[model samples]
Target: MTQHPMPDGRRPANQGPRAAARNRAALVAAARAIYAEHGLDAPLSAIARRAGVGQGVLYRHFPDRAAVATAVLEENVRQIEQAAAAPDADLASVLGVLTWHLTESAAFIGFLHADGEYRRSGALARGLALAERVKGALRGHLPAGHRLATADDLMLAVSMVSGAASGLTRAERERRVLAAWRLLGVEVGPLRPFDG
Candidate 1:
């Protein structure tokens, strides 16, 4: 096969989409682990080393720390979408999944809360769009006479759960989340225990 050299002279351009995807996944996973352990300020070089990729590969996939962080958050949104689309998923189950995710992903959540970079990079807007998708997916599951009319209402419920459960245990957070659901007039059935 004829080789097309990259401008950086480190790797060939014919690495294939699969290899590129693998590298991107590795970088995102490494960023998640390192950010969880050392916070978002962890060096890009450290992330590249952990992913077993060169700095150039990591840079090619994610131009900066905020891009990496955004990718991580985007993955989270995709997962939430999957959960919402599950056959047996209802409003309660979807909310439970989101609660569990937020509970286990405290570091990422903290980064979203503290870093203005996400807003500047448009990640926050993308996240809000995903949130709207979740809300739309759950709308059909709302109980009769319940009033979750808009995505903003759903977002308010999420804020309540996240804010109320701060510093609480996983179980406590689930309880608070369930309570928030009830308070929002969404009459969800009993929730499974949060596995996180």
Candidate 2:
């Protein structure tokens, strides 16, 4: 079978999968940066420009803004999952990591909350699923007889932290995050450092 020319007029190094993955990663990174800088309403063209890829590549990787948002949320959830899985991570460490993530992700989360269309997107569903996993991990770390009643409760706590801390200084945001954790009956130990 003859291979088709790639979108940018370059021949595939090893078929399309590798290039597609790289393009998708670049698109996601661009989307994250653009959204963080300009909120969810930022134009898709901006993401394409930032990724150094054409609009075709961006559309191929993410069909719409919600899809882009979903990719970012999925990545955030993956990082939180990794933190939860760390051998030495305890409840406090987990919360600390989550706090950092939620704070950093406040803008994206706000956009998700505000965009009605995103509420019904598959990405949102996946995000909620990953969030449940996070809640399960937190439950595993809770003291015996202490448990969050539902994943919704965990999400609410996250929302509270993000909403309450928006535009605040890092120290203030950390303070709000710790306070939110305390309200959830989680022990707020030393805040953990996060690379993101």
Candidate 3:
């Protein structure tokens, strides 16, 4: 049997198990872009359209909005971990990666922060684990007697940084994160301009 295009000339989504990974990756990428631009309230149809897959493909991979949102966050953590794996990677450089993500991933941050129950999200746990490792590096870089963030301090800082980014323009996020961090006693030096 041939897999034929529909009357509109668009082929149906491939149903092979091999295609599942491709389709799932596509859905997560599309969801990330759509949510970044229009937020978590963006229509599921838009993510399907953006991924060039059907709505069924999207729903098959992700049972709900939060599930997809969790995947996006997981992907973000994976990227951070990859960056931190570099030989020359240090606390300041990794902090730069975090700053960049906090500015760009406001939708995911907002969704995860909406309720205490979301702490159960696997992404959140992976994130905390990553934060733990990053802290070891951060503390090594600190001068003698300098403060390191406690777990509670980090949790609060994330909330405040995401609060600074929420509903803010990109430039505003760049501005306000500095203010938020300053409140936590870290002075961010000059940063290179973020490309739009």
State TM-scores per candidate: 0.68, 0.72, 0.69
The residue-by-residue lDDT of candidate 1 on 1-196, one tens digit each, is: 2245668886565658888898898888788677656667889899899988889898888888788987876776666677667778777776666666665454565554555676678776766676677566666566665566554666677666667554435566556666766676665544432232
Clashes counted in candidate 3 amount to 0
Question: Cα miss at 47, model 3 (Å)?
Answer: 1.1
**On a 0 to 100 scale, what is the lDDT of residue 10 in model 2?**
81
Q: Which stretches of model 1 miss by more than 4 angstroms?
A: 1-15, 110-116, 146-151, 164-196
Model 1: lDDT of residue 150: 53
lDDT of 2: 0.69
lDDT by residue for model 3 over 68-183, one digit each (tens)? 77777667656656555657655555555666667666676656446553555554665566556545544444444444444445545656776887554767777787778777
Candidate lDDT values, in order: 0.68, 0.69, 0.66
Clashing pairs in model 2, backbone N/Cα/C closer than 3 A: none
Q: Give the per-residue lDDT digits (tens) of candidate 2, residues 1-196.
A: 1236789998656647877888888887788778766768889999888988889888887888788888877776666677778888777777777777666655665654554767766556666686687777666676555555454565566667667655545566567766766776766545544444
**RMSD to truth, every model:** 6.4, 5.2, 5.3
Best by TM-score: 2
lDDT for 126 (candidate 3): 56
Pairs that collide, model 3: none
